[model samples]
Target chain A: SQKIEQNSEALNIQEGKTATLTCNYTNYSPAYLQWYRQDPGRGPVFLLLIRENEKEKRKERLKVTFDTTLKQSLFHITASQPADSATYLCALPTDGGSQGNLIFGKGTKLSVKP
Target chain B: DTAVSQTPKYLVTQMGNDKSIKCEQNLGHDTMYWYKQDSKKFLKIMFSYNNKELIINETVPNRFSPKSPDKAHLNLHINSLELGDSAVYFCASSQGQGAWEAFFGQGTRLTVV
Candidate 1:
């Protein structure tokens, strides 16, 4: 079975610092991986996505790196602000299934202090 | 305008009751999906539909059924809802079935009493 795991503990960091979150997977090779930001009492919003052949992808202050060898992906938020405090989820396409389905990680809660 | 929208943002009902969560997408996407976010904040895929056709059905219970009448709509109906069913349900849509970024709705918080 495929499994996705992120840092379950909340990460507290000061504003302007860089926050890095980890997402590790087991038992499958995904075609692509995506990251989402979810606020309290709301649905997740898409952040960035990286394909298996890509080493890194970036959008503004956000950066995502995929390591197929380790089956892990790291999400980075630079110059974090209080507005960046939210749960970040990592998702990937399930192997041997329809491309529409995404297997998500437990997510890591990030808190940015001002 | 909201790209993806769901009705009954919050639903609280008793066990064994039947309820439905309606979802509609105006993004013109061909694929829609239903996902459950548990109390622990773990998101799991429950069902997926493309152009009103069932595409992906995870290990979800039969009590939970998804109906897609058209490309823009997918509704979830739950029968004999249990306490374990209490969670937030999210509806999402993508441009196509291949790997693509998904837009999510506001979500329906279902609490089974």
Candidate 2:
């Protein structure tokens, strides 16, 4: 069986500090790995996606690194703020061939305290 | 101008009742999906429709069915809902099967009494 695991415990960080989240998977080689942010009671918003061929991708303040060798992806929030508090989910294509069929991991809850 | 949207942000109903949650996307995407988020926040895909055709169907129960009248809509209907069916259901749309980005609607939290 395929499994995607994110740290279940909440991550607490002081505002302005960098927050890093980890995502590990087993038995699936997804061509694309995507990240999303979900605030309380709201749908997840797509943040960034990195392909297996690419080592890293970046947005305004978000950075994602995909390591197929270790089967891990690290998400970093630089210059984090209180507004960055949310559950971050990592998803991949279900069958590796169907990109629309996504399988999501239990998100890592991030809390930035001011 | 919401890309994807679901109706009835909160739904409270009793077991054995039938209910439907409507979803629509104006993004002109070719694929749409339904995902369930459990109490522990584990998200899983239940169905996927592309161009109004069923493309992916997971091990979901027969009580739950997805109806895609057109390419822009995918509705989820639950019959004889059970207590275990209590979860947040999300509707999303993507450009195509091989696309990596998906836009999600604000989920509808369902409570089975």
Candidate 3:
């Protein structure tokens, strides 16, 4: 069975610092990976998606890197602020391709403290 | 306007009761999905519908049913709910059964007492 693991413990970082979260998977090689941001009592909002062929992707202060060989994806938020505190989730297609069904990681709760 | 919206942001019901959560998407997507987020905050896919047709059904209990009146709407109905069924349910949609980002609803926090 495919398994996704993330940092179960919450990440606490000072504001304006770089916060890096990880998503590692085993027994599967997905075509693409996605990152989402979820605030308290709210559904996840899509942040970025990086394909296996792409080494890294960046949007504003957010960056995502995918390493198929490592079966890992790293999500980074630079110049973070208190408002950036939220749970970040990593999602991959269940079938390893362009599929509607996605399996999400347990997510890493990031707290940017001032 | 909200691209994807679900009604009843919060739902509380007793065990053995029946409830339904309604979802609508204005994104004109053909693929819709229902996901369950437990206390551990793990979002798991339960069902997926494409063009009003059942596509992917995970190992979900028969007590849970998903109905898609059309591509724009997917409703989840749970019967004889158990305490274990208490979790946040999210409705999401994508452009199709392809490589597209999904837009999710506000999520319905269902609590079965």
Candidate 4:
């Protein structure tokens, strides 16, 4: 069976430090990968997406890198703040076809301390 | 205004009961979906509807039925709900079937007692 794995443990970091999260998958070749930020008691919000052909993608303070060869993606939050703390999820197309059918990872909870 | 909205942010019901959760999106997207997040915080896609037509239906149980009255609305009706059905249900929309970015609703937390 296809699977997406994220660090089940919560990541604790200083407010000003950079936070890096990893997402690894097996048995599926996705054309692109997406990252989402989910705050407690709220639904997830889209963050950034990186295509397999692209080495990296950036949006403001967020950056994402997709390495299809490794079947892994890295999400980095540079100059992170307390408000940036949340559960970060990595998703891929269910059948490597449509975004409407997304399969999400278990997600890694991030806590930034001030 | 909220882009994607679902009714009854919180629902507490008993087993063997029938219930329905309403969802609507004003973003005018071509695709909508239903996802269930269990207590373990695993979000799984249950159903997908595009242009008021069933597109993707996962290995969900027959007890869970999705109805799309129109392009803007998709409702979920679960009959004889089980305790395992308790989860946070989310409604989301995207511009097209291939669209990567999706806007999700606040989610409805259903608790079965």
> How many residue pairs collide in each prediction?
0, 0, 0, 0
Q: Write the per-residue lDDT of candidate 1 for residues B1-113, one digit (tens) a residue.
A: 99999999999999999999999999999999999999887888899998888977898999999998889999999999999999999999999987789999999999999
Kindly report which residue pairs in candidate 3 clash with one another.
none
- How many backbone clashes are present in model 4? 0
- lDDT string, candidate 3, A3-113, tens digits: 999965599999999999999999998988999999998889999989889999999999999999999999999999999999999999999976758989988999999
Against the true structure, candidate 3 reaches a TM-score of: 0.97
* TM-score of model number 2, chain B: 0.98
Q: Return the interface RMSD of the candidates, in order shown, one decimal each.
A: 1.6, 1.3, 1.0, 1.4
| Model 2 agreement with the true structure over A1-114: per-residue lDDT tens digits | 789999655899999999999999999998889999999999999999888899999999899999999999999999999999999999988888555688898999999999
Docking class of 4: medium
Best by DockQ: 3
DockQ of each: 0.72, 0.79, 0.83, 0.77
lDDT of 4 by residue, B2-102 (tens): 89999989999999999999999999998999999999999999999988889879999999999999998989999998999999999998888864688
In terms of lDDT, model 1 sits at 0.92
Model 4 clashing residue pairs (backbone):
none
Candidate 2's C-alpha lDDT? 0.93
| TM-scores for candidates 1 onward, in order | 0.97, 0.97, 0.97, 0.98
lDDT, candidate 2, B2-88, per-residue tens: 999999899999999999999999999999999999998888999999889998789999999999999999999999999999999
* Tens digit of per-residue lDDT, candidate 4, span A78-113: 999999989999999888855458899999999999
